[model samples]
Target: MPTCSAHAVVDLDVTGATISKHLYGHFAEHLGRCIYGGFWVGEDSSIPNEGGIRLDVVEALRALDVPNLRWPGGCFADAYHWRDGIGPKQDRPVMVNSLWGDVEENNHFGTHEFMALCELLGADPYINGNVGSGTVQEMSEWVEYLTRDGDSPMVRLRKANGRDAPWKVPFWGIGNEAWGCGGHMRAETYADLACRYATFLHNHDGNTLYRIAAGASDDDLTWTEALMKAVSCLGCTSRPRGLFQAISFHYYTFAGDGISKSPAIGFTDEQYYRTMVKAADIDRVIAAHSAVMDAYDPLRQVGLVCDEWGTWWEVEPGTNPRFLYQQNTLRDALVASLHFDIFHKHAARLRMANIAQTVNVLQAMILTDDEDRLVLTPTYHVFEMNKGHQDAVSVPVHLVEAAPAVTVGDQELDPLSVSASTKDGRALVSLSNLALDTDTTVRLDLRGRAITATRARILTADKPQSHNTPTAPDAVAPADFAVTTRPGAHGSTELTAVLPPHSFAIVELDLA
Candidate 1:
């Protein structure tokens, strides 16, 4: 456990890759109370909801400015039948959500409810179609019901259900984790099915559908290779375009052993370090998969979409075992900032990534209690602080000095995680100090970018495991960060800031 100062060299002039706003997307599944009690509490409840959706949760999510929301499932998407969930509230068939908690799904939150929720949050809808237990025609008709503008059976049924105008859903996931819960199909088999599903998926109201195929699980590059090859083979003789726009990948960072045994709260420093080590492993996974994708798509036309990802730990005490519920600690915030930096660096191929969920699930942004109570997690603050990096050009950051490694390992984990972006004469630099014990004061050298003024905000806790609860919601929140900048002796600008241990900060600079 040695201490070492870290330094970052940022070049504003040498910049490329515009970070897509969709990278800050979120996920909402029908698992647990994520829909029933979390976001949808019945309009008649005393929670002050709008159309059975919690207004407080909606306002909190709106504050995050969530770009896109993937709905109806992780594993639940494959088993879900859209038709069963639509129609009258009471008449809708109540089915068993066997994938989640074996809990009864009342089918109240159907397609109409989901699209309405998207509209309320001002986020684009990214729906996951059922490709395993459902048929191709069923999936096509569901898309037609939502996106089709012309008069058709599906559209007419949608109007009869209540909505006259069609909802614009640009992104569609052909399947989710096909190699796992979706179907457990082989790489080659899933690829062919994905291409076939995309064929019948029609565009409505001139809305171009961004069809995404189910991709690899962790380091399974063969899946990406087979899927891309299958998609590239489409229209080889007749046309020249690929069938899929992007491929989806799902990776979750589980603490302790890779199994489902680790607890969420009350963890030792060793467990915390191990969790971070797993989080950093995502960089390696992305690199390996991106290289495989390059073999099929040398032109890099198709984007890499991480539709499902986050920290998955054991369920909370006394909660449903199948419901993946856990408290979001400062450690979770560190994990999130680390991924954001990685996504920014790989913005060329990594266009969009959605955290596992937005509420009442693993590493959620907001958690709700029984009635009229909600608290924002530290991870939520991380997203709020780093939101400025959206749609900004990625600037290269070179480490001038090595950062101290975590006590758990000798390998350098890049304790000083840094990413920079510049847009409209403004530059933003996000830094995360992963050292759990020691704070590091670093010197920032902004190459070819003159800084006139600067401001910052930091999210940290007195302890590494500090988190917010319903009773004590303000336990961990962001405060105005103090940073110093002045003219260097060599006629260049130099910035210095002290990053507290296990903290994340965003520095905004006014460039001249």
Candidate 2:
């Protein structure tokens, strides 16, 4: 392979647009430990739980300031019947989670439990409706059960289920992965189903529910264009409004053959670079999709929600592969930061995004063992570092100098992912050196705008192949950064730090 040379300015000032609150959203599915041991511990378990929702997991998520959480599945959403999860736990039939494992989904943790958990975390609930095996009335009644205070059949059932009033869940997904998991419908077919479902979703609070339509995979431009035209004809512009408030998109970073069930922890530079290459495409995917949306609606009002994203590999050997479990390493952490930088690159139109699974499933922010829970993956640390960009406006900056290129297999990747944000006269820039083989010297040209170095954090491991275990949790912990200031030409204040191979870093600066 030939060496690639590049120097491009990342002017964050390109658009002074604020990001939507949905950008900080996350997803949780009915896969493996994500539910049973991850976030929900039944009343019989020794784990301390509030109505079966694990207290430790909820506490860990609160620290990250988690904005929203989508329940119940990626594929599970289509099969789940909300009513079965309500009423009486004993009377509710035990159903098989065919989408995940052949395990029984004992209806112990129901709708009320989830709402109670979401309330405690202060994170809004985004429920993906079952369009594949459900009805408009069922979806409508779910909205009523959660959002309506009136005396309806669902509300009556909710009261009987031990809840006095409705639980307001503002964000509702019309469907999930219509092209694959959710019945694999054509765009036109899914669009029609979305129109019907969205029509029945009652926005009780008057706040328009963020009704997200299922979108395309990777570069399926046709899928997105078809949906946009469908929405246009479906009629949100007729003043009475349209069924869709947002159009959803899904993407994942998988190494090797891209088929799931890849190994965890012990990976080569080839696998690491391939993962980064996949992650780096998030921005391009959003941009290209947004352009298609613009052709139909110039205002760019339709939101592009990246609902399912993260690193996917096979589960640990003895563990269930369908569970989608893999260890979080410094490599995964950098991938998280890289995607955040990409999202900020298009903050204007790319309103909401969510990582695949929040705990113990796929790309989880936190993992669990028995009653004890830990922030397992590098993705968790990246969220801690980039929390500032959660709901902040994108203040673009022009990135200068030639960045080293990393290549593996047949793909090439940029070593650094850069994004900037300005608020209250302070310009904060986050740059992640995503190279897994070596550290690159990152020179930030702030133009003499000196600010107090507000401490830096680095997440690394003793070995590149290290994985977190029950006995050793701190194998990859953050350390006091080597923050050295450098004097540069033309009002430029440069700072240098070592971003470990397959690691992540963040620098905070104030404007002069």
Candidate 3:
């Protein structure tokens, strides 16, 4: 328990990349209560719903300015038939969710319900198609049904379902985890299938699709290389650009041996440090995949989509094991901040990222109970504070005097994480102190701009494993932070603040 010191510099004029808003997107799957009680409470229920879509959930997510939402899957998308989740709820078919659990899916929340949810939240819909068991024609018609206008079989079906105008669907996924739950196909075989599927996923009525192909699991660069190689045209004057717009990969962090994972709470200090090491390793994972992509697509035409990424832990005791529900803690918030910092650094190639299931699931922003109660998790506050970075210009942050790295067993962990961006004549600098028991004072020299005023906020709790429940919803939340300002070398401004251990903070500057 010692005091640490660090120094960093932020250059305002050296901005090149605009952080894509889609990078802050979210994922929703049809697993356990994620769909039934988490989002959809049924129209007849007393929880105050709109078209069977929970209004409270929409209201909570709207505050974060959700950019986009991926639907019907992680693994469920590959087995889902778009036709099942549309039309009348009473007449819709019921199927057993074999992937997550053997629970019967009543098809209550389907295509129209999902679109309604998106409209309510004003978020773009990114649909993942069924590639494992669905046909090319089936996938093609689903697009037509969702986005096409004028006369057609799909349009007729849509009109019969009580929708007149075509919805604006921007992003689509060819499949999900083709190496596993999506299908047991090899990388080469999936690549060929992806090409065939992308060829037929046509743009209808001026609605263009950014189709993403299912990519590697963790560090399997061969999967990414195979997808890029399949789309690239060698020995030709120019390569194709629209065969597939992007590729996706999934990564999850845990601290346990083999399939077992550390519990969400009551974990030891060693387990906590080990999880931080695993979370921070995403930087290496992204760099490795980006290198492979740069070789195949030198011009950076293809984007990287991390559609599934978050912390996975043992399920809450006494809950359905297949539900994938775990409490979000202060440590989870630090992990999120670390990921966003790394994501901002690679904004040039990384276009979109959706955190693994959004509500009542792995590292969710909001957790709810069977009754009319909800609690915003610590991770939710991180998203709200970092919302300023959406679609903003990325500024370079250089650590002049780096923080001392903490050694955990055989792994070394950098306890200080930082990222900065500017938008609307204001600059936002996000920092996190990952050390478990040491306070850190950070000095930030602001270059290329004159700062007029500054405001700061921080999120932390008594312990790293501290979480919020229905009784103490505000146990872990954000509060105003104090900072000192002075003159720096070469007529620059200096901002200094003492960041608490295991905390995340953001400084907002009014740039002149």
Candidate 4:
């Protein structure tokens, strides 16, 4: 049993504001129906779409205020050739997807369709270029086609294909997951390629182009070190930025849970503990990634974007395995909420992150079947619940000691997650009780500031594996939180809220 003061205050020393808008960012890949049927359903169909893009799905993502979207692929980005997917859909060449399901791509959704989707959702388009299968000339032309104003091959192609104006895609990636799917190149090799690819990238003034270097996999500190050191010193003449706006990292929560990894929660102690352990590791990965950046450039310059992250369990069996879709439960909700806290706590260097998907792909925010849709996954509720964290400045907190490390399989976790902030003079305390069971309560004490109403919203399910399917849409969802009165307690308050077996709750306090 470990205990200490849970008292804390908003220190004015931390001036950096947390970029909350980014937490709502999402990932869109060329996998399965994620892009073709899931997002781009074609204008000719009677499925009620906006010029081929699913209108209802668009509306749902819009509601979440999705700020940015990474496109052209996940691993697919590595092999993607922008030219093949542009010009004319009829003329666009069809290719086989070697990385994902080995499916045949019809080239139906191209630059115009992706750009159009970005416009409709009011999100920034972050395009991952094909470093493994594409050349420097190809990457350069793709950027010019979208961001360049005057005549260029890409611009001319855009006009000839259909559109006449530039789409202004400011965010571009030199490569994606290069170490794995992009290309199994040494960090040294990838670093040189990044410089070369970024050299040809050009965007109009007022529109900054971010050329992200493909970063390391989980715990690959050496990879980050090698890339950071190589790029910081290897300056390019044409592009002075030298491919250093940000470095992209991809990670998945796969602890060998296998087909047994049903819902994110509701497991034997082994299952619950394993899921939480993986979720807790997020902070460590961020810290290590930031540390590597710090060593290279002591001054905070290169940002770390965990561009892709989500639980990857066996596809819910009989369904198309390529969908990469799974059930989102309370455990999943907590995983998402906790990750938000992790990134928010390290906002200075960890600038951007996107859940593996937005809809019907991986740990999606929204799931759809035909015309019917349900927020479905607790992940959706978690994002909606933690909306307060979007763009809010980070506030420091001193957490009292907790029971020593909780072990799950071969690993251990901190069990307690906390991230706090004050925006527009309002204080928000986001807590994720990573503990599997036996409530671990915190007697929150605000020494410097006075708090008024402590309103709370929670996403909790009775069992860790609890989930919502199309048939029973309301299985696990966010419910009104019951806050307790102070009773006879003076100059103090308490809210004894059950955190569900494995769930996340956001507590908002109106401080006077």
- Which predicted model would earn the best TM-score? 3
Worst 10 residues of 1 by lDDT: 233-242
Ranking by lDDT: 3, 1, 2, 4
TM-score between model 4 and native: 0.90
Model 3, span 1-512: residue lDDT tens = 69989999999878868999999999999987778998999999998999889999999999999999999989999999989988898999998899987799989899999999999999999999999889889999999999999999999999999999999998999989999999989999999999999999989989999999999988899899999889885332355457789999999988744223678998889888888898899899999999988887777889999999888988898888888999999989988999999999999999999997789988898899877799999999999999999999999999999889999888899999999999999999999999999999999999999999999999998899999999999999999999999999997999998998999999999999
Q: lDDT of all the models against the reference? A: 0.87, 0.75, 0.91, 0.73
- Candidate 4, residues 259-278: lDDT per residue as tens digits? 32554333566766776777
Regions of candidate 4 where Cα sits further than 4 Å from its true position: 1-17, 233-241, 256-267, 370-375, 401-405, 409-411, 484-498
lDDT (Cα, 0-100) at 395 in candidate 4:
76
lDDT of 1 by residue, 309-367 (tens): 88988888888878878888899999999999999988999989999889989889999
Ranked candidates, highest TM-score first: 3, 1, 2, 4
Q: Is candidate 1 or candidate 4 better by lDDT?
A: 1
Cα deviation of 320 in candidate 4 (Å)? 3.1
Q: Comparing candidate 2 with candidate 3, which one achieves the higher TM-score?
A: 3
Model 3 residue 14 CA deviation in Å: 0.8
- Count of clashes, each model: 0, 17, 0, 11
TM-score of every model versus the real structure: 0.96, 0.92, 0.98, 0.90
Error of 1 at 479 (Å): 0.6
- Evaluated against the true structure, the overall lDDT of model 4 is 0.73
